[model samples]
Target: MAQRLADLADQGCPNFFDSQRFGKDNSNLKRLAQWINGDINVTKRHEKSLLLSALRAAEFNRQLGQRVQNRTWQTLVPGDVAILDGSNSHFSVASVDAELSARAAANDIHPAGVLPGADDSIAGAPPLLAELMQRERLQRAYRPLRLRIQQLAWQFVADDLILTMRLPRGAYASGVIRHIFDLQSD
Candidate 1:
């Protein structure tokens, strides 16, 4: 189990926003959809913010999921927005070269996925999210697709495994756990 964990740690985890970002049973996302379609109105500032956050998180997750499916989550692709490690700074990729590939492999940078909003030109955005962007006039952004796990350590106590690691801000611990265990969220 320890060796397996080590191997998994070296591979990093998909930078997915865990279920908590969507609220209970993803109620926030549902509400955002309702508001987008004009079926409901969100007037409160905090409520509006929450709905917007959920929308962005959902879109980011969708984009990251696609990269994972295509086995490109950890590799550089043409036209990818690459984010600098430990920073929000990112740059658009015109093409993938050896330097970019090496930086990605060394965890010096990561491929970013889009957070849908106004002026987001990336094609194939979901119609609902695109509509929300058009209605809200929100600014688009990017988030890294791979999360690096630092100082990973694990131990067994009384037949239970305990894991510890440091993740960057806005990163979910469950993102690491999912690679080692099957997680079901309610």
Candidate 2:
């Protein structure tokens, strides 16, 4: 069972953001658009923080969409930030090589995209994504573009199935659920 769990974890999960990220009626996104348009004037620290987060999340989602369209969301690209599985540590891959592709395919490393911010530490991103970061005034930072489940187990009970799993800190559960279910919007 332990080996099976490890094998399952190595299969990897989609690196997409779920609806919960957009908030109720995507109000966070509306707030972000307002801030981008200079229509919002925030004096409170919390308000500023939320707006910043919304801005970043919006950009991340946009980049994720592009990756999915390009069919590279599950694979590594040249000049991509490859994040090490289970660690915050990551390094830039200047070019895609067979070994790197194999490693990424094995779920040992993940390709990351930018989380717009002004931080100087965020480096080695694709040119277009970096440009978008500057235009959005999002601090340039990298976030693992993938999520890997740990200790995942499942069983069928009657007509329903139950899953037990652990995700890394900051990983969203909705991403995993989406793969197995067609969630509806209410």
Candidate 3:
């Protein structure tokens, strides 16, 4: 069991925020919008936290979707903050050169998207997005563009394929599973 745990830790999964953070029908997000627009004042700390989480998740998902659509989620763009795989350290790419592109392609590093927070380190996203964030009064933060899967294995049993793996904190198992199967949630 100890060895198994060690192996799982050695291989980390992609970092993604799970759906639990977003309430059903995104009601929390709607409430957050009301608060941001000054239509409501959130007094409870828990409620405020939920709203903040929803907003951050929404922003991160938007950026990730954009990158995936452009076929550049695995690639890097200018002014992108690239995080080294399996490590927390990251750097800003002011320009895309051959070496940097090669590194990104090799998964040595992946581009990160802003999480919309108060003290973001780098600032190079689209101006329109920035404007929107400004209007929403969100802070700036960075999050990786890609989610990595490691030590992935599966087996079929009784008409079910059991998948076994480990994911790093912030990565969602459902997010990974959804990619493999068309699942419907109740």
Q: Give the winner by lDDT.
A: 1
Q: Residues 1-186, candidate 1, lDDT per residue (tens digit)? A: 787788767867889999889999999989987887789988888998899888789878888989999999999899999999889899999999999999999889999998867777435545766766676778878899998888889999999999989898888987678777856555
Q: What TM-score would you give candidate 1 relative to the actual structure?
A: 0.88
Model 1: clashing residue pairs? none
Clashes of each: 0, 6, 8
- Which is superior by lDDT, 1 or 2? 1
Can you give the TM-score per candidate against the true fold? 0.88, 0.78, 0.74
Error of 1 at 129 (Å): 5.7
Q: Quick one: ranking by lDDT, best first?
A: 1, 2, 3
**Deviating ranges (above 4 Å) for candidate 1:** 121-135, 184-186
Q: At residue 138, what lDDT does model 2 achieve?
A: 56
List lDDT for all candidates, in order: 0.85, 0.71, 0.69
* Residues 2-119, model 2: lDDT tens digits: 4444555677555666666677888876775666556775567676667566656666777877887787887888789998888878898899999998988988899997776654
Deviation (Å) of 169 in candidate 3: 0.9
Which scores better on lDDT, 1 or 3? 1
lDDT for residue 57 in candidate 2, whole number 0-100: 68
